[model samples]
Target chain A: MASFLEFRQVTVAFGDYVAVEGVSLALAPGAFVSLVGPTGCGKSTLLNVAAGLLAPSRGEVLLEGRPLKGLNPVAGYLFQQDAILPWKTALDNVALPLVFRGVPWGEARERARVWLEKVGLGRFLRHYPHQLSGGMRKRVGLAQVLIAGPKLLLMDEPFSALDIQTRQLMENELLRLWQEDRKTVLFVTHDLEEAIALSDRVVVMSAGPRSRPIGDFPIPLPRPRDVAEIRLTPEFLRLHREIWELLRGEVLRAHAGA
Target chain B: MRGLRVRLWQAGLLLGFLLLWEWASRTGRIDPFFFSLPSAIAQRVWRWFATGEVYPHLYITTVEMLLAFALGTLLGVVFGLWLALAPAVAAVLDPYVKALNAIPRVVLAPIFTLWFGLGVLSKVALGVTLVFFVAFFNTYQGVKEVSPLVLQNARLLGAKPSHLLRHVYLPAAASWIFSSLRTSIGFAVIGAVVGEYLGSAAGLGYLIAQAEGVFDTTGVFAGMVVLMAFVLALDALVGTVERRLLVWRSKEREGGSA
Candidate 1:
């Protein structure tokens, strides 16, 4: 069977700067993958390609055997930033995707309320984005992306700014939610530990000017993994060490380049 | 308690200033002919109000102000969004917009009188010109400056063009557009009155012009006072609307960033 999404020989350039080069990757339906790389190593550019936010300067992005165009209809994106509209209350922000999808306002709001409750933001219905804490806003962002039920999820370091405790809690929440139906996810982050803890496979990329995947490691961890508990295991540590070895060199190169 | 204290201070300051002015004019510290005694001005204003002579002029000026405000704001938002969304079109129009903005729109009062005649049409036309650019620039900036990340997330979540405009563009621009509306209220009123002052059959501007021609210092002062009152009332109206519409932002200011 065809992989649900494919990035074939994708290269992205902005004027004189080449962000990503000759990158080919595939994701099976329901797979969870994390792309780990150094800062400015084209992780976000790659993610944007998947989201169809930026067309690759070279190569094609295919979704379910179709060449994707404009915005990818099958995917939802969670930005590194909260991305929740500050002008909207938590409930309204979560309901925004549904409203865009032509759902009736009443039903969209009802579903958004349920989703917000699921994300543990039941009491923050009327609270604006600014009123909520960062974690609360992130939860709102999660509810916003998930409420629309896109088949593929693209998250760009969605929790990199959170305190560790909040990060772990949100990671576990994401896992629990994703487990209800194993949705395909493409998560990008610089943190190797985070990559290994949350994803079924971790792909490491070299530093830019022409960043491309250096290694792909399929995680052998068991299902129903607790992100916090799984970290204490030797297997997680070994995988972390191995991925860090591959990633640290690229990070150093990026730092030198900067 | 704090708000009341501030209001008390404001009232005291206003009363003190008025008393000082009244005392100075009455005691011949300043020439009453040019400065105009505050008491006489007050009496003149009262007479206009009591005798209902101000109504027709007020009505004409207000209609011109409202029409200018409504038309300018609508055109500004629509055109601003269009230009922001279509960069190519914006590029073409960029020079023209800037050139129009650079010219003092107040100077167009005379030209508007020639184009639209010595009626409310001329006044409205002048007011529209004054109000448009401020609103347009603000709306353009508001739309242009929407967080690209937020926009990307919206698109990935399946927001279509129409949905993007309603949910993202308008809400992002809401505060800016409203700010422009508030600022342009003063300009609109100025435009109408200035146009009328230049040449007109009826309006507060005409009344002021009539007073100025006869060197009736009290009438001029009263007209000035009436114009001030009109502007304050309109500003208050806008302030009320802003408070209601931007309730979400108010919550943001009160809440600390989480």
Candidate 2:
């Protein structure tokens, strides 16, 4: 199978501090991949590099064999903080990508309404970011990216701030979106269960200043998986243990660095 | 019922103040020559309006105020957006803008009359000067305070620089701009009145100056009442526009409360 996205020996730096060093990874088309690591392990930095928000100080990022130069609109990003604009209604926020692309206001809003409905926000289309609960805001944020119809999605800990129940519900909603759209997704999170529950493959990273992937574990669990049922599986437990073991030392080292 | 109660309370307060003023003037506790009774002022205002003496002055002041307000606000928003987005430009112009803002703008009325003549132009110039800084500073602060995370999300969504400005920066700064507009209304009125006071043959300010020269306290009070009414009307119009544009915002608040 051909690689859809490639990060070849990518190194990202801010002045003297290198966030990611000599890191290499490739993702298949329409694949669900998760990067699991301790906080500050540069998972977000790697994602940023992929999204072309940060310039790689070394090596190259290729999208479908073409060198990525600037921001690629084909890649949609969902931030950890929801980042829905406080001034915009849920529908308007969802339609923002279309607006940026110069779609007419009436049509863009109509399309935005469609996406809001998809994310179960049909009733709250006129609601602002501040008006929505945390879970609903996250859903709105997801709808924002999804409405753009990007071939690749980059999510940075998109559900980290939500409560456990809401997180699970959001995870289910995300999985449903992913299943329906079949877009390639690169999700970054520290939750082992979440990584195991959602991804086709989990890339585990060591701590930063020079963070790189230390393990790549394939999740063999069948698709259309329920969060509760998946957690009950021995395979899920085994993968969780493997990832936890790989991440344990890195987490400790990150704490020590802090 | 709640809205009605609030309205009743406001009306009662206004009536009580009017009664007190009327009592003070009728009882000779306050000099009617210097401080005309509210009833006398009202009578004078009615006669002024009935004879169409108030219309020309009202028209003159309103035109000057609206023109100055539009010109000042447009320039302020443009310059403020420019300064906030460009660090080098902001650094270079920061001191000059601050110095201009800090100076007493009312002192410029005479200079404006000298430069633009004793016609409407001078009043407009004065009003523009008064209104500009309030809008400029507020818009500058607003654009500068746009959340970094939101900007990142926009970039990730493939928003071009212009798109970012239109969808993110402008909307982010809108509430701030509206807030400044409310303040700028008073400044705009001050600018026009000050210019007229310095040199003009028409406008409510000119009427007041004439009344003061003749010791016609009723006429002076009537002019002030006219000015106050005009300002309040303009403020109400601005408020209406704000409510329309911010419909999405209030809906969000309602959703949150529910």
Indicate which candidate wins on lDDT: 1
CA lDDT of A226 in candidate 1?
95
**Each prediction's whole-model lDDT (CA):** 0.89, 0.88
Clashing pairs in 2: none
Model 2 bad stretches (over 4 Å): A105-114, B1-16, B250-258
- DockQ for each numbered candidate: 0.57, 0.45
TM-score for candidate 2 (chain B) = 0.94
The most accurate candidate by DockQ is: 1
TM-score of the B chain in each candidate versus the native B chain: 0.95, 0.94
lDDT of 2 by residue, B1-258 (tens): 999999999999999999998999999999888898899899999998899998999899999989999999998999889999998999998889888888898888878888889999999998998788888888888888888888888777667899888878887788789988989998888988888877799998999999999999998889889888888988999999988876656543421211
B95-118: candidate 1 lDDT, tens digit per residue: 998898888877887888788888
Per-residue lDDT, model 1, residue A122, is 91
